[model samples]
Target: MPAEGARAGAATRGTQPAEGGPERPTRRFPRITRDTARPEGGGRAASGAAPAPARQWPLLVVLGTVALGLLLTSLDQFRPGTLLIGVALLAGAGLRWLLPGVGMLAVRSRFTDISTYGVLGLAIVLLAMMAQPNPWLQIPFLKDLLHVTLSNK
Candidate 1:
């Protein structure tokens, strides 16, 4: 048994034969290379170059124009004014879709899709509430009781 244990230890010591003729070369840290010297250019190599900052002025101007126009149209408060507001909203949405990544506007756009769904949800809720003669507005006591029961469960 001791001899077998010795043989087993010796067998494990040497490199085991790979399946193929030679083992595939691999680096422990794959991203590192022998060339540690920094390339020419003051710390701003090709790979490390920062992306250009997006121009936001144009987008801001467009948005401001749209808002001003919408405001002017909406001041009337008649049926036509309401229709114009709807049209303005639709045009804004279309512009958003057509020109993504225009200026810093893209940041605000992240919520656009979610806001559309949210608006739809709110409209549905409003319609449902309107359909019901009495909309339930929970009192503070009722809300607290509900919270307590839910927490206990």
Candidate 2:
């Protein structure tokens, strides 16, 4: 057995640090870097500079519509608010489809974006219709669909 002070370290043949030296800096992921490339022409660049970023007008429009809808709803205007929200969603979908350059709006792929927007808009509209005291857009199938029985009778 070795002495207490004589600890058995790594079996260094020859190349090993004596005792005190500056520790080597280790590299880590998610490095923040600046984007300094400037666009040459007004259009999309071919190579060097980064591609032209997508426009944001479409998303802004959608957001503005939603804001207006929310304000109206807060003012006890249920019908118009619900309709406006549905319109906003639908319009957002149309914008995403027609104007491919909707920066933040283009979250998912083209097919996914359109489908998600369309489905969500339809659901909101349907829910709004059912929310009325005397729902004008009454569908027997939908009423039946909502009636779920969990009891084992």
Candidate 3:
């Protein structure tokens, strides 16, 4: 019984073969290997190295525009500042659409990015126009649209 138990334990661990059988290769969970030195040319790969910094001017433009808009609003230019913010968001959407490969701006899938930017911009612009004592950019359909949207009980 002791001999049988020993054989079973060894087999389960893959450490040693059964007493009377041929030796088998040890089953290692993780195999380790030595790190080889890099090829002589340089640390960089043979392929042309990619640019060190990401191109993000479009993203910067969007952010800077929004910051400017906020500053304007803080200076008591509410209407113009809101318009600027809306325009900035729309521009961001356009930038993303036009430059899909721009780094950092590709936070979400393309469709998601465009819709989010467009919808937020449209909402802001519409709300800003409607909030004024004398609304500026009036859309007849927008009234009916808001009525139907908000009238839901």
Question: Who wins the lDDT comparison?
Answer: 3
Question: Candidate 3, after superposition: displacement of residue 68 in Å?
Answer: 0.5
Instruction: Give the local distance difference test score of model 2.
Output: 0.66
How far off is residue 46 in model 2, in Å? Answer: 18
Model 3: per-residue lDDT, tens digit, 65-120?
99999999999989889989999999978876775354555566777888899999
Best by TM-score: 2
Residue 48 in candidate 1 has what lDDT? 26
In terms of lDDT, the poorest run of 10 residues in model 1 is 39-48
**lDDT tens per residue, model 1, 118-139:** 4553544343333323543324
Ranking by TM-score: 2, 3, 1
lDDT of 3 at 75: 100
The global Cα lDDT (0 to 1) of model 3 is: 0.73
Q: Report lDDT per candidate.
A: 0.44, 0.66, 0.73
lDDT of 1 at 49: 40
Q: TM-scores, in order shown? A: 0.29, 0.59, 0.56
